[model samples]
Target: MGDAPTQQVPGLGDVVGYLDSPTAVCGQRLSVHLSSTVGPTRVRLRALRIGDYQGRGSRLVWQSGAVTARQQHEVEPAGPDRVITERWPVATTIAVDVSWPPGMYLIEIAPLAGGQPSFIPLVVRTSGAHSPYLVVASDLTWLAYNRYGGRSLYFGPGSNHTQSVANRSYVASTDRPVDASGQRTVFKMTLPLVRFLARHGISYDITTDSSLDATPAQLVGQTTVLIDGHSEYWTKRMYDAAVQARDGGTNFAFLGANEIYWQGRIERDARERPTALTVYRQAGLDRLARADPATTTVQWRHAPLLRDPAALVGVGMSVVGVHGAYVVNTAPAWLLAGTNLHKGSVLDLAFGNEVDAQEPPGPHSPANLQVILHGTAMAAGRTKPSLVTAAYYNAPSGAGVFAAGTTYWLCELDSTCPGGPTPRATSGALEQITLNLLRAFAVPRAGRLHPSAATPYESPAWLAKRLPVGGAATGEGQ
Candidate 1:
């Protein structure tokens, strides 16, 4: 085969790299590793405060001097898992100080001659942040889907078009380039919210899923912890930490669906640095049922660990490959107080991709669950349709939890979605609802002040009969 074409933008030559660590504390240091075909490269680092600043999408926080670019050795995937370890030489080292606020940042590297730049996502964390809200970036999920060296946790290395777990990796390394620098999830889910928060003057701190797994104590004393985007993977420590925080009256808002579904853990190196995410998928066979069943990499709701996510998030992912809109069930409600939306108002294209629904009033569900939005989506190859629900509940500890029941919620904040542009009116209503929830949850023990009203549709028997669509919304047992 001919020489591989350089990964470049516009006029720039190829240059790809990853940080020695995905995250760094404000006072710590981080190294940048790069392999470039470009003669000389310049590093332009920016902390993304407001994602879309006049359509630029970033604010220049920091920049580094031009560095010598060296063409490093081409390392391919090794071992049965096809883990690509990029042990490139450090081109530059950065000292993260007080100027670097704790938030999501992007490091852009390109040729000094000017070209399309490559990006690396970094989360600057703080140990003693007492912000009323905490936003946990779904870094683990981004790393899981990272297909840098032609392989990822979901697809094997090759030109094979089919994406199957059978040919996928059981482990994904953090020391390699993540496809597109994980901009897809970061921009779609986290950045929009960050922009919204900054615009609304909401003070919130940001951290990574790994940080939550490593030092979950940071979650303590916070009023609310926001888990946004497709947070699919979770470790026992992360799960327990969230539950503990919630029980301690720290409210939570899962702004996206398909969260806390898989069980996984971060494997650290000898130096105690996170090197890879190891998840040996049980895939329904419960292959590790006998050995360390508690830590098996199966669905959290599966056997050996009958911990249903719905018990925590108010709703669990029930359907995949879903495409539809959210049909309002109850408006003039607390969340929809300032919005123009009312019962039966359809938020077009608000539900797509994956979605969650409360199964029934069982042991896995919250006791006083209130369904805010209910709709239906037809899943692939299913004779019957599945219900999508956005709900809220007040825990016995007086902590409130809101589940958006759809992964597309965050993107809708900017009127952007997979299928098409979300209607401006619909986006405005959703934004108002989000603002209401955040404002209410910013206070400690918010449920005690503004508790969820009881709903009759919490029962499976009741939900089985109601359609909850347009025209009949008021009679859906609200």
Candidate 2:
């Protein structure tokens, strides 16, 4: 919406590809499947650590120039009853080396002709004692909503763009490219935070949503686990592992909202790798539930399971989208360490459309969960006062769990929103809080997670907290 494109910077045509695996442990073999819009494509493949776009920028780590892609798009019908299947013959495979550090790496392939750059992302995981935090990507959620070729589970075939499902079945394949805009959570939500992490010299390992589903035990021995940006979908194993990690003293930080809200599982590719994410609409998922109850593919908090996400994340899904200022509800909370946000200071549009909250956290919820900050957004179409939340709770094992409770938490880090660029105070406030979070989390302790430490209230605190258009000197919303 600004002078530059917010995501999936497209060039001459579309250069697309997928990784052989969603993640790789250091010293393991990882493959990049490359394809292009033009024939016999020649491009430069460069690896960059996601960093501050508005400041230091994502820095290139390793690069190999003059790589060629020779694959052509191929389609095979899965039709005895299915619609279609799209596959690209392998163009080129790049073997990852042990020299690459453990972190989230974005492989950017740009045509020598200088066209739009296509990116393939993968987490370089490490189970060793070196790295402190594990940054997990929501690849499952990315694959869940990807509508590449117009065949997303939510939509019908590309030819029928009416948003109706009558024409297509409820399955999406990982064989296809990610939606043209790139993985929304990664590019827009997670990457910014990753960039923030890199800029600040935070040492962490990176893994994806699929990796968690495949082997959640990989979480053992980590100081903290970060599930940042739109981690809305999950497999039972992924959720359980994070819980187990928490129970075992591994801290869990949920930097974005709507995490673990849906239930889904992985379906293997032809090569027998778990590449596809399978989720059915409620009715379709109900049919599967009849066959195998454990594999039921539906919303987590509803029928058959009734497994509410709030139990793990400290908040549950309520509103899908809201646009408003984020008001500080707790001035004394340890999370607000450096920002100096008082009861009324606001972060302009810090809480985006989707947010999580207590529908009244039931008995199963963690007894120590505390409200960190309370906010209200510009409602899309609701009559009630909009409420967004930030939460924290500690486990007896010394592990602490945090929920930012809004998907827009990372998107606001750069002081830019869909409404246009916001005030510096907003960016400064959000960034400082995040820095405090990273610094606090890197330690083996949870900072300021106190159940009995909450203070008195400030009603409709938005009036006292908002940062005005030109940047305010009131030491409030920035």
Backbone collisions counted per model: 0, 13
Best by TM-score: 1
lDDT of 2 by residue, 1-478 (tens): 0012344333224567776776776566656667676777788777765655456456566777687876566554364223234566655565667666666667777788887777666677666556778888887766766656545556555445563465444555666666543365566667766776766777667787787777777787778888887887888888788878777778778888888877886877675576566677473534567877766777888777678888778777756656556667566455677787887676665666577764454565566667666665434455545457777777777777788887767767764344345577877887888777666777554633533243333333342244221111121110
Against the hidden reference, what TM-scores do the models get?
0.89, 0.85
Tens-digit per-residue lDDT, 1-478, candidate 1: 1111111111222777788888888778888888776545554443444444545545666777777667787677787656778788888888888877777777767557766666777888866766889999888888887767666777774445564445777788998876642445665666667767766778788888988888879888888999986798898989999999999999999999999999987888886778998777774443455777888888899877899999999998877776666777776366788787877777876766677887776788886888888877555566666778898989888999999997778877876555457788778878999999998998878888878876665442344355432111111000
What C-alpha lDDT does candidate 2 achieve relative to the native structure?
0.65
User: lDDT for each of the candidates?
Assistant: 0.74, 0.65
lDDT of 2 at 363: 62
